[model samples]
Target chain A: MEFNSRIPIYLQVIDTIKKQLVTGKIPPGNKLPSTRELAVEYNINPNTAARIYKEMELMDICYTKRGLGTFATQSEERVGEMKKDITMEVISQFVNQMEELGYTSDDMVKEIRKRSKR
Target chain B: MKYLQTENLTKKFGSTVAVDGVNVVLEKGKIYGLLGPNGSGKSTFMKMVAGLFHPTSGNMMVQGNKLSILSKGEIAFMPTEAYFYNYMKVRTVGEFHEDFYEDFDTAKYEELIKDMNLDMNMKVSALSSGMAAKLKLAATMARDAKLFMLDEPLNGIDLIARDQIMSAIIKKASEDNIMLLSSHLIDVLENILDEVIFIKEGKIVLSGDAEEIREEKGKSIVDLYKEVFAS
Candidate 1:
């Protein structure tokens, strides 16, 4: 994940891991990118990455097995959780775009159906 | 009336001054981008305005009223870190917002939830970082406060998501409202902000109308930022 100099770096770490989890790039029970590895990958302060992981662990997005590296928390219901969390922010954007394009609910549904076909 | 104003605001951590002598005025119905380098005091400055950290010296007033005295119901602060009950479902967060913020619009929140294609039943703890950031944005934007202070609103999320976040903020902002957004993404904010305020070493380095700053600086706001915040 590329870190923007403006936003706090810990946030970038959180965003990156979130994407990995949602895309199944890091499935449940999967060992996460080590704090050191994440720090190196983003070229950020290691302390910052550790802080992000610690926050995620608190959020129950990941768990530490002790003596072993941190692993993705096993939750069959997580995909729904993530979708709801992301959709709230994304929906407003979608509504704004539809407003810009002058698309009504019917038009939006049709567009979605059309997109789904292919 | 000025939507948000800070009077001689000063914030210090231990002996370190994160913000010093900051007297800023953000007018109603305008978006102000608080720009600065890392640890240059952008977040601290925002925190002070949000009343997260009491100004060690000085004061912040929203709509000419001191924010310190006003209840949390009046001002909505979206910190860079997502603040939600991880154990709660997404729908429950909406209830929490409604309960805390007097101006929170539950209908708007629910509509946004559906529009975003999110499952209201999902637990917050199961969300990814991007999801958390987005959720934070939604929760904050759902409020009908006089002032909205967003610290690094687009700090996370993909380029597409960044555009979405920006669009949401723009759509939600109004003449009766003030949106103070701090982000390192100068390019994204350059066109959106009606005014620009730059901070360096805990002081207001430069601030003025965005267009005037562009005209006076003789460069895009991004270029000016690069020059001002040059490492």
Candidate 2:
């Protein structure tokens, strides 16, 4: 994935993995690659890869088993909540941008209604 | 743990001070980008660490030992210029390193050679500059050393080959060794650098964790590079 240079790369990677997890692209409870493997896959620094796993673990998005490697969180309810959180986050961003463009809430609803019918 | 530490390390070419009192502490399991423009003392700093050039002042310690012959064995230095025999085949280069460094892994060399798409039968002199760069990187990275110092590893290489070289570097990185790569190509090296040291006119001007620098400066390392070197 192309990264925005201004932001911390680990944060971007975390979001990417979170999206993958919520979308079922990386299925729940599935094994995640080792830190070194992830570094190679993303072409990022190995230390940054370790930090990514550490942050994910703290957020409860993933957990590790000694010598068995890290796995995605298996709790379906947690995954559902994460999906809603991400959806709201994205919608807020869109709403803010539309607000700047002089689009009201009714206008946005009408626009979405118009586009979905097509 | 500190793998390499230098205190006021300086190098002088007669009256010209090439490296001026560079003090830095490098730890194991991290990849450091020694970033600077050409003639910014990056090479001089690396050579001193590699034990090729004696420091005019101060000293450096490698794994708690002063820079010595034994430390050279643990350090793998890939110079910018091509340093290969014209008559040697691509395979012979690996064998030559194997004979010189006890830590040289022949199997890893062969795998890197294949991954680099270099023919073993090809003559070293016959390969293009890009191929030679790849050859140099593969040879240096094949060494199972405690410290790996590469000078301008991405110089004179195409885009595709750059990706291959970066992949090779990422594969060689581990928690047991320190990899120091000097490059002016900040954008290409930025993502893979755990820390970045910016050297200018023979002195270190700025140094910090890569991500933390970006977070604090509100700009990428590339932008910071431009800001630092802008005249």
User: What's each prediction's TM-score?
Assistant: 0.64, 0.96
Model 1 regions lying over 4 Å from their true place: A1-118
Q: After superposition, which runs of candidate 2 have C-alpha atoms over 4 Å from their true positions?
A: A114-118
DockQ, candidate 2, comes to 0.81
Candidate 1 chain B minimal-lDDT segment of 10 residues: B65-74
User: Quality of candidate 1's docking, in CAPRI categories?
Assistant: incorrect
Each model's iRMS:
14.3, 0.9
* Candidate 2 RMSD to the correct structure: 1.5
Q: What is the lDDT of residue B192 in candidate 2?
A: 98
- Residue B75 lDDT in candidate 2: 94
Error of 2 at B122 (Å): 2.7
**Candidate 2 lDDT, A41-80, residue by residue in tens:** 8989988899999999999999999999999999988889
Residue pairs with backbone overlap in model 1: A6-B184, A18-B129, A91-B116
DockQ of each: 0.01, 0.81
Cα miss at A97, model 1 (Å)?
A: 39
